[model samples]
Structure formats: structure tokens, C-alpha cells
Target: MSDIQPRRSYVPPAVRATSEWSWRLLLIVAGVLAAAVALQTVSEIVVPLAIAVLLAAMLAPITQRLARVMPAGAAAGLTVLGTILLVSGLFTLVGTQFSNGFSDLTTQVATGIEQVRDWVRTTFRITDSQFDAYFDQIKDSVGKSGNLGDTATAVGLTATHFVAGIFIALFSLFFFLYDGPHIWGWVTGLFPRAARARVASSGAIAWEQLSAFVRATIIVALVDAVGIASGAAILKVPFAFAIGVLVFILAFIPIVGALLSGSVAVLLALVAHGPGVALIMLAVVVGVQQLEAHVLQPFLLGRAVSVHPLAVILAIAAGSILAGIVGALTAVPLAAVVNAVGKHLFAGESKGEIEQELEENADKDPLARR
Candidate 1:
């Protein structure tokens, strides 16, 4: 052969480079899909662990402050207890509001239903007998499907999962708070020796991102809840306290959750008052949301969790498609953490730059400073 067969195919350097990249990209994609499948299979544990991590991030500053005065275990315990008490108090308040308002709500709903029925009958020219027949048909179709037992089984399983998840979250949160550094060190130790330092740096960046996100989210949610609840109270909406609590809880899930929960307030207003009050309630909800979007989020989140609005929407959509409500709730924070960590790893910032970044994060959160 004349010294390597005279370049048999004459493949260009650009074409050869592209061919090399194409396979590597496909392999990476395949690996990602495989990982996703694995995660889904163990989602029960994964979900609880993820929740614990977020909760730990939220409680970390408090725990750290307490740790300065006491043992880490005690600090973690006290923090967890305080969180439980606060949550229980909220639930109790919501329950009391619900109990007090239920009778009036029922009356309003009944009256509204009657009015709707009358309007429907008049407009559609439907007789009572026709309505009864339609309802009977619906009942017959449901009975024919024979899914009641299956539905019951599904509900029971869901209840079990919920209880289990709660326990797992609590246990993981305790350990994460008490032994966070050791745990992280152990995890980083699992990597190859050469990668240990970079992995630890990436983890630190991720944790900072998560903490900033949780803190900002808490502030934003509180503001949203207070704003909406105050509007409801001013309008004399039924179960105003309950609506506020519900909004506080739902606002954690970002845009969709607030809208859905706000719609509940709107529906209650429509039933209890009328379309006039309901429209006013709707305006209040929209106004509060606008304030959050334009003012509060920008000031609170800043550059710490700087995910774009389009990315947020897309992440929410993808998460909802994958795992319903839980996925949607977690998607944004997860995306932000991933983005921050990915940037850190790829850019390989100098020690001074990393220290500067940490300083900036700490400046944003007063609790973060030693």
C-alpha cells in the first residue's frame, strides 16, 4: 500500500469531527434517558429525599444559628419541632375557619345551584324528568364501568404512600440538618480522587442556589398569601383565612398553583356574593400576582435563582407532564440548582471568584453570614 492506501475516502476534517460528536451526543442522550427511567422507578424514596433536601435548605440558617448555642442535634430537633408547630397551627386555623364558614357556604352554594338549574331549564327547555333521566344515565355509565373497587384500592395506596413519604421526609430532614457536612463529604468521597475537589465545589454551589431559592420562595409566598387574603377579607369573602392559608401553601408551586387556588376564592365569591364581587375578587388575585411577577420576584430572587420566565414555564410543563403536581412544584428549584452547578463546573472559576460568589449570596441573605 502506498503509505496508508492513498486516503481511501478523503473524509474532510469537519465531517470527521461532526461524526465523532454525533455519537457522543447520542450516547449522552441515551444515558440521560436511562437515568430518568431509574429515577422514576424509585420515585417514592427519591421524592421524599428531594423534599427533605428542600426543607433542610429552608431550615438551615435557623439550625446553624441554634447550633452556635447548642449541639447540632438539638438545633435540628428544635427547628423541626418549631416547623411542625407552625404548620399545625396553620392547619388548625384553616380548620376553624372552615367549620365556622361551612354552613353559610353551603347555603350560598345551594341557592346558586338552584338559580343555575332554573336558568338552565328555561334556556334549554328541559323538564325535570329529562334532567333526572340524564343523571340516571350518568349513574348507569359509572356503575357499568365497575371501577369503584379499583378506585378505592388506588386511594388506599395513595394514602399509604403519603404517610410513608411524610415519615421519610422528616427522618431525612433531621439527618440532613444534623450531619450535613459529613454526609456531603461522604457523598463527594464516592467520586474518583481527581474529581473530589470539583465535585465538592459543585455541591457547595448547588446548596447555595437551593438555599437562596427556598428563602426567596418563602418570602414571595408569604407576600402573595397576605395580599390575596387581605383582599378577600376586605371583600368579606367566606373562609378568607382558609383561602389565605391555601394560597400560602399553593404559592410554593409557582404560577399554576396560585392561579388554581385563587380560582377557588373566585368560585367562593361567585357563589357567596355574586358575579360583581367575584369579578372584583378576580381583579385582586390578578393584581397580587402581577405585583409578585413584576416587583417581589425580581427583588427577592435577583441573580441567585435567575431562571428565565420561558425556562420556568417549560420546566413546569415538563414536570407536570412527568409527575403531576409534585413534579411541577419541584421543577423550578431543581432547574435553578442544576443550572448553577453546571455553570460552576464548566467555567471552573478561580478561588477568588468562588469566594466572591459566596460573599454575594451571603450578602443577599443576612442569616448566611457567620
Candidate 2:
């Protein structure tokens, strides 16, 4: 009885492979779920910090240039002040437009409502009593739904949160622009020395991609604004410039943003002008987007942070689902950084190879050199 042979259980190759893939897939899903939960849990802090990082990335170059000719403090202060002024001016402009348009917009909306009512009455042959009953039902439903005071309180709370986030963003932005290099070095230094170069190099690549994307986006957004605004103006749309500004701001979010903002513009055109102008405005929006998709992005961005359109859409959708608009705004940049970092680690490229690749990329855009 010394040794009844122990039976060996063998997994087929396909079964083994399936088991391996199953655990890996499960691990990835679990990681994503954990990250999403963590992000949601600390959204108050993370949103502002993420926004500050983006602002710092955009303004760092200007700060650096200004620093060359002035003290770091003065340079940073100037950059921050300049950004504040620019943002203030934009808000002020939009407010003025809104104030100027509000009364007319209300009037047009009322008239549109009347027209629709008239059409419905004619089409359906509904009596005044029936329409009145409908309105009463709607009023009853509204009254039953919730209290006005509660809605007001919710709005006030949101405003308070916004103000606090703004303060956080500004406070973080100043430090980021001023001590960014030192902070980055300190961060990378925390990694083991053996892999420091690769980490640093990868970060540099991500930064380069971010800067290029930002610059290209700004340029594309401006062109989109001008093109659409000009059309709106020609079509005699109310709040034309304001619509353009909204488009410019939203354009930073890429494909879906443009479509949404453009749709708003078109709707306003329909309300303020007419169906004809609205149709023309819609065409203008589509044309400009086409130009952006084909010509501007490829030419200006130059494959630096070229995530696919489908990837962009998916990232935005996922981000919005996870963290609302802040997530949406940060999604593309996060995607670009991830893509760059992955490429930087994709092959076992040496330091020289990485530097050479970066040099070649930089050569594609003269602005990238500095």
C-alpha cells in the first residue's frame, strides 16, 4: 500500500487561458469600481484639485516665459491675475448679453407658446374647457411635486459649493504655477532611482501632449466661435455673441460639447429668428465641426495626443457617469496622459530612445521646443 499513485488534475490549455483571462478581467473591473468609488467619495477635493492641475498646465508656459524676464512671484501673480481678468471679462460679457436678451427671449417664448397652443387647438379641436383642465392638472402636479423653498435651498447650497471650489481652485493654481517644477521633481524623486528617468520622461511626454492639446483646442474653439458667431449674426440671432462664447467654452470638452452648445445656438436661433435662420445656423455648426474634425485637429494637434473619437466619447460618458461634469471636463486630458504614459512604458525603450522620440515630436511643432 506504500504508494497508491496520487492523481494529478490537469487543466486543458483553453481552460487555463480562460481562467487566466477571467481573473485579469475581474481584477480590472474591480479596480475601476474601486477608483470610481474613491473618486466619488472625495469629489469635493478631487474636482478642484483636478481643475487646478489643468489650469496650471495651460498657464505654466506663460508663467515660465514671464519668469524669464521677471521674478517668479511677479510672473505667477501676473499670470494668475491675467487669467482672472480674462475669465471675469468673459463672464461680464455673457451677463450683459443675457440681460440684454432676457426680456426679448421671454417675449418670444410666450409668443411661441401661444402659437403652439393655437396649432394644438386647431389640430385637435379641443375646447377651451379641456385646455383649462389640462393646465389645472399640470398646475396640480407641479404643486404636489415639491416646495419652492426646498428648490431654492438646493440652489443656494450648490452656489455655496461652487464658491468654495473656486477659492480652492485659485489657491491651488497659484502654488502649482509657482512651484510646479520643484513639486514635480519631488514627486518623481519618490520613485526608486532605477526607474526615475522613465517615470520623469513619461510625465514629460504626457505634459507635452497636454500642452499641445490645450493649445490646439483653444485655437479650434476660437475658430468655431468666430465661424458660428458670424453666421448667427448674419442670421440676426439674439445673443449671437453669447452663443458663440458658450460654444467656445464648451468646445474645450471636444466632440459632444460642440454638438450640445451648437444645438443650443440653433434652438435660440429658432426662437429668436425663425425656422429659416435656425436651419442655416444648424448647417453652419455642422460645417464648422466638419472642418474641425478634418482639418484643424490633425494639422494643429499633430498626433500628439490623438486618442480616437470613439475613445473620447466613451471616456466622457464614463467620466460623467462617475463624477458628473468635472469628470467629463477632465476625461480627455486624463485619457491623453494615460495614453502617453502607456506608450512611454510600452516597449523597453532606453533613455536615449525616449529622448530621441521626444525630440522628433517636438520638432513637429516649434512651440513645443520651449
* Cα deviation of 298, candidate 2, in Å: 1.8
Best by TM-score: 2
User: Candidate 2: global Cα-lDDT?
Assistant: 0.83
In order, the Cα lDDT scores of the candidates are: 0.84, 0.83
Model 2's TM-score against the true structure? 0.87
Query: Top lDDT: which candidate number?
Result: 1
Candidate 1, 17-44: lDDT as tens digits:
9999999999999998898788788888
Q: List candidate 2 stretches off by more than 4 Å.
A: 112-150, 351-370
After TM-score superposition, the amount by which residue 334's alpha carbon in candidate 2 deviates from its true location, in angstroms, is 1.3
Cα lDDT for residue 47, candidate 1: 83
- Candidate 1 yields a Cα-based lDDT of 0.84
Kindly report which residue stretches of model 1 are placed more than 4 angstroms away from their true locations once superposed.
1-19, 114-146, 350-370
lDDT of 2 by residue, 85-141 (tens): 999998899899889889988887676556656766888898789999999999999
- TM-score to true structure, per model: 0.86, 0.87
User: Which residue pairs overlap in candidate 2's backbone?
Assistant: none
